[model samples]
Target: MLPEIITPIPGPRSRELAGKLRRHESQNVTYLAEDFPVFWQRAAGTNVWDADGNRYLDLTSAFGVSGLGHTNPQVRAALVAQSADLLHAMGDVHPTAVKTELCAQLSALTFERWGAGPGKVVLGNSGSDAIEAALKTSLLYTGNAGVIAFTGAYHGLGLGALSTVGIPFFREPFRTQLKEFATLLPYPFGPAGDMLRLRKELVATIQRRAIGCILVEPIQGRGGCVVPPAEFLPMLRTVCDEYGLLLVLDEIYTGFNRTGALFACEDSKVVPDIVCLGKALTGGFPLSACVGRADVMDAWPPSSGEALHTTTFLGNPLGCAMALAALAEHARPAVAAQVQASGQRLKSALEKMRSPHIWNVRGRGLMLGVELIKADGAPFTDLAIAIVTRALQDGLLLLADGPASNVLSITPPFSIDDEEIAFVAARLQEYLTALPGSIS
Candidate 1:
């Protein structure tokens, strides 16, 4: 379904909310502007209703978290049912049965499916939590402090995960707060031609530094949905094996059919030692899981009753139940194929048009990026921002992605129909066609 514009973009109600938010909330948190920041009242499927009653076709999927669509019925029902049964649980002590079941299902979905046996899980509240969990697990298992991560990669902003983050913009300011344990290598694109050189460097780095693991996003989400060559994961897996280092896949954004696979790494069949998952895990709940092979995760010593690493809401009942429901939906055999078909339709439409402002269109499934650029070939960061602002007025929500913020990212929900895909491409075409002359 296409978006319907009612009141002006942010309209009166959104402006009121923005003013209140600016006064009480951290100024650094949300960007405040007259024509921006629509306060979402409610969302469902692929549509979002704002405070001003404006309905927009969601292209962001709320930062790629609602892959099963916003407020999925089954997930919502499970969440409500779980709340009636148990509002909270002492995670480290007396955990809920929902958590137990969720963990078992996660093991079967991941390691068991890969023929790696059952996996152990560390539950968390956010994507960052999952990243940190994987980092800690890798450290515990390999007993090495150093980590290898690719440049242009984003693995969340938590302190432990921050050290391994490749975006200099995020890492530079907090460099002092972060441990000097991560080595950032350039992320490759195009063919696997230069992979040999990269492999040599990676091997040397592993030997020279006390590297515990190689952390990566199978399809770099925040990094402009950058899809590396098919050899990427296989290469990492081979090196990690040779050096006896863990291969940690941060599938937070690329998991749950976002990349037309249960996990993007599945396309390569490269089973990771640790997989950090979140975003679409519970469809709309604050939940995440860091799953690792049983043997690898067993590196952690048994809890001395007190539990060394535990959160108050480690396995929240509401989130766990929602996750169970989302998992069942994601397991549908047709989901991945449907996503792939939708992706091709959108990709083909975007590629058919030629514009000076368009640099490239790339990515898989619903996770795609239109690389906005200037006539001079430099990144059109300003143009991308302008497009997002303009698109919001058109009852379409979009986000500029990557460390440079020059990629117009499209991460719509799987529930988006063919008509919705056509609408997105049409809107994007208009933006692309109009931006060249505007860019300076």
Candidate 2:
């Protein structure tokens, strides 16, 4: 229930395991640092115990995948039930009963509830898979190959998804392999006039390229949880409608009550033609869905005994069972309220710090960011990473993301208690206050 750091972080056992991993696994996969990358041995609720048995409060929710809480009882029970009856199945061909149920529930929760007809579902194993599915659907439905994405957006890293990924760091190495179908536009965060001008630029790009869809994240998660103005989504919706472009919302990070609302787009009252969902969809299981408007999704021709797009683990039964249980838990009214309250408490605590290094603390619900900057107004990337290191030593596990890696990403499970939130706030303030005058 609370953090208990028994030994120094990266304790003896973790160091040994990290050494083993460095020898056998790809070094590029996991950043192996002397004092970082603690291997998780167990996680429950808002806590994670490293291999060395050091317990720490999790603020990242394991990359926003455990919204309901790590190893939620209901989801675990569902996993157990599914494992006994069935485990894996032919996702695209001979589907399991739970998969069908999950697809229907996802449709009901999204498109159907949003005034669209029953939604069409394309299940996948990761967020990138879902994004690719949406991209493919857009291409087929609109008969256009090009897509419009935002600079600060992070859809995924798969080939199809990477084509539209906004981060140049991820795409640079694979540029030759990519199809060059994506055009990145500056994500808006300024004013009404800026958004209006963006609309004009969007129209110009649509006219110049074979643009079929516009892909974006409602609240840029990996992009420092940068939440645009209220007019941002509505402006995109207006332009998409006027130009016959499909609006594809990548809610992989902001979905499942992380944003107070079930989906961030709901607050804006803008219904995207297609939405990619993952991370917390199944608590801990690897499952994602690309749910689209019935009319838009139906653009794919019926299977002629063969599917156009699918994966070996497309709709694994275990994932479906857990997803069903997680969705049921999200249906409870307390989940949203808990998220909103917990977020406000954490945000308020951070704002009260008044540390000069603090630039901004903004986000909806549990998905919040604390931007760190130097007096010169440059992103404090080194200090942000240092803060993460210091926080870890103090029994708080967080991440610094965004282009400059200067924003502390604080997305905890909805079930986190006020005490844990207080612990995190106190630790953050301590770290910021201790910095030298030259930096602060």
Candidate 3:
């Protein structure tokens, strides 16, 4: 029921709106260049209808936020019901019943591996704040100021989270201030990086120096949806254990049945000390949490200790209530199994393309990537942009990421139907075929 492009994208109304928005926004980073910025009028399960009445199969899922689908009925009901009851509560000082219930669900779901008395949950408004909280927790637990992060991994943009950012372009502006806190390591991907050597280097760095923790993305999101080698996480776990450093896994993108498994870490049986979750955690609301081991979380006991971290909107009632519903949605075994099956189906379709512009298709679960290679076998940055632009024209919504922002990241909602997936793949093929170079 998609591909309803009655008018060219950015029809008169859309153009007018984009022009107005341009006045109040930075055009460089906002709109995709080729197509008109179709203003969204409404959205439903896996599809978005623009102001012009043109519909698009939402492949990116609003940057991985609406996992259960846009304005999901359950989430909307929870939001409406909670808002009507009691909206605000003092977060850490005074908590509500919904807040306590939400935390109980999160604790019950996560600490299944570690036979736990009680794991702690600290709430925040965004993924970045949750990550920043984890960083502080790590520092407190180990009583050290140093941390380790991998190349091409994106944790968040806050000072503490940004310090662990591996991309030079994102970190270069703030490097002068961030260098004193964290060390960067090569992520175990590609052909050349030796895991054993990297492991030894990490151990040496953490043991000799005052390293408190190592932050990693269980499945890199902003970094081209890269799924590092299978052994990579377990090796890091071993290194962290040996070095006495807490392992903080950022599951902002990989959690909530996005990665086929309950959490991507479960695939390898590696338990991290601290886990940061966001994006789809609250279905489609602004909620994030840093849940971890008790000893690590209890680093800041409330007796005259410098208030380690606190956000104004922490443990928001509406957000918590919505998250409770989202987690319940995640718990359904059907959701997890469907994500794995759909991911494989899409991956197989991409692999069958045989396009010369494609370098390779890599990733897991609903999160996948089509890495572009030039005719010379090097990365084709411009072509990737062109492909995305062309895909937009064909009524498909896809985006690019990675350090270069050259890889086509295909993260459709987990709830997409088979027909919708086929349409997306067909649109991609049409775009590739229209390019000048031969695909085969």
Which structure among the candidates has the greatest lDDT? 2
Full ranking by lDDT:
2, 1, 3
Q: Which residue pairs show backbone clashes in model 1?
A: none
lDDT of each: 0.89, 0.90, 0.83
Instruction: Indicate the residue-level lDDT of 423 in model 2.
Output: 79
Q: In angstroms, give how far residue 408 of model 2 lies from its true place.
A: 0.3
lDDT of 1 by residue, 1-440 (tens): 68988888788999999999999999889999988899999999999999999999999999998888888899999989888889898988999888999999999999999999999999999989988888888888888988999999898888888888888999999888988889999898856548888899898898799999999988898988888988988999999888899999999999999989989998998999999999999988899999999999999899989876778999999999999999999999798988898888878887876677788899999999989778788888988898898899888899999888999999888878888877777877787667545535
Which ranges in model 1 have alpha carbons more than 4 Å from their true place?
435-440
Residue ranges of candidate 3 with Cα displaced over 4 Å: 26-29, 32-36, 113-117, 190-193, 303-307, 436-440
Q: What is the alpha-carbon RMSD of candidate 1 to the true structure?
A: 1.2
What are the per-residue Cα lDDT tens digits for candidate 3 across 1-440?
Answer: 57678888767778878777888887666663436467889998888888888888888988888878888888888999999998888776777999899888888888744565567898898999898888888777888889888889898887778888888888998777775587888887654548788888887786678998889997888988777777888988887887788889999989888889889999888888888999999877788999998777888677353345776777889999999988888888998999999999988888887577877888888899988877787767777787777776777788889888878998888878778778777777776777755353
lDDT of 2 by residue, 73-171 (tens): 999999998899888899889988899999999999998889988998999999999999999999999999999999978999999898888878899
Ten contiguous residues minimizing lDDT sum, candidate 1? 431-440
The TM-scores of all predictions, comma-separated, are 0.98, 0.98, 0.94
